[model samples]
Target: MEALGDRESWAAVVKEEEEEEEEEEEEGDSANNIGDAIASTDDEDALKRRISAHPLYGKLVEMHLDCLKVSVMGDVAGDLDHHETRYQQQPKDCNKYPQKMLHQSDLDHFMEAYCVALSKLREAMEEPQQKSMAFISSMHSQLQEMSAIPIAHSNAPAHPLPPPTSSSGK
Candidate 1:
């Protein structure tokens, strides 16, 4: 009788373990379904997540910013630390650049030029612009004045930017 009772208890234990495993699998499937639904809702967000997950994302961001700086201000030295390619921590020198410092027209013009170059580069590289756009939007949001950069205006004309002319005439 005791042996039979032990057998019955072991069967009950096995059943409970199987039930727990099934519940855990169900929970995992539900979580995956939720994730898939969310991902499907916003493809851009999913692209951003994947881009940021890349091991060299930080380096890519820094390099992109450096290229942007060059596009904006020409290739002058001393803006970034050489070893780490990090921006230098210099005190703001508004007096030195009174007319040129973050003027709306200049910012608009430079950014437009940069966008043209970026599009060309994207085409040459044969990579989708969604990844680059995600990085750019993220960087733009980090700027101190949100209005410094322009998003599209409803009334604005959708025209392709002209090729940027070199001031150096090169």
Candidate 2:
């Protein structure tokens, strides 16, 4: 019955292989289930993962301290070697700027004046100053500060930015 003994040993090996395969699949399934449960809980963390490694802020507004908004832009634009855009190294004379700067409102009266242009953000995208948290946000996006450029040049191309796309779709 040597053949019968050989058959039994072969069957035992096949059975052991099947059991190991099932165990490995179960471990992979358990990891995926935990990942799915955690994904639904934290959306902001997910968004950050999708965003590109662009600078946290823009570059030009740091060029000088002309207005309250410009001064705030300066802080966001600091530490620039890591950024995508080009910026001038501030001159040693630039360091002579007052250690203390004026409050935003003290620098701009129109911060209160709501012109059709200036007032629109106050009307549309945001609430009135009395209700707004803009001052406390610590940073604002590049688009919000464009209206008050200290100097203007026509050659600056009016190239529209491409619409945003998620990482998966692209």
Candidate 3:
């Protein structure tokens, strides 16, 4: 009877230890999951902030929107031109004459917007071109400096080569 009691106690202790270990593993998994979720959220927010704050990103987005506006304006202008041409071809015939397509005020507005967009695009292009030119100039100067450096060879003369003489006497 005493031996049986000792065996029962040992079994109980073992079961308790297993349950504790399982609970600990579950807790660790939950912590890892929570950490991953937080990290993912942080990364997404950081990306959004970076995109919104980037100088080039804003410029690119503006340019894209301007281009879209310009495209729409061009389409409208084309349609107007077509109508004007048809009207001109048949000015006397009311049936063939084209009706008023777009208001002059609307055209003026779109034109102004188009001009502004073009100006902005040109400005953007100029900045990059200026930077590129400066970079090119710097690189050219560096190359010139590098070329001016005299290289030493084992079997070459210290002085530069003499000018070649004509085969025929001058």
Model 2 — which ten-residue stretch has the worst lDDT? 51-60
Ranked by lDDT, the better of candidates 1 and 3 is: 3
Model 3, 1-170: lDDT tens per residue?
A: 99999999999999999999999999999999999999999988865654433333333444554444444455775765565556446424322322332224554455456557766775675676678789999999999987777666435677879999878956
Q: Model 3, which residues run further than 4 Å from truth?
A: 1-103, 151-170
Q: How does each model score on lDDT?
A: 0.59, 0.46, 0.63
**Candidate 1 on 47-77: residue-level lDDT in tens?**
5554444433344555565454444333343
In the range 1-170, model 2's lDDT, one tens digit per residue, is 99999999999999999999999999999998888778855655644332211121112233221222322334563534323234334322322334232233432332233223333432443344424566555345554565556443444656756889779955
TM-score of every model?
0.25, 0.25, 0.29
Between candidates 1 and 3, the one scoring higher on TM-score is 3
Clashes of 3: 0
lDDT of 1 at 46: 48
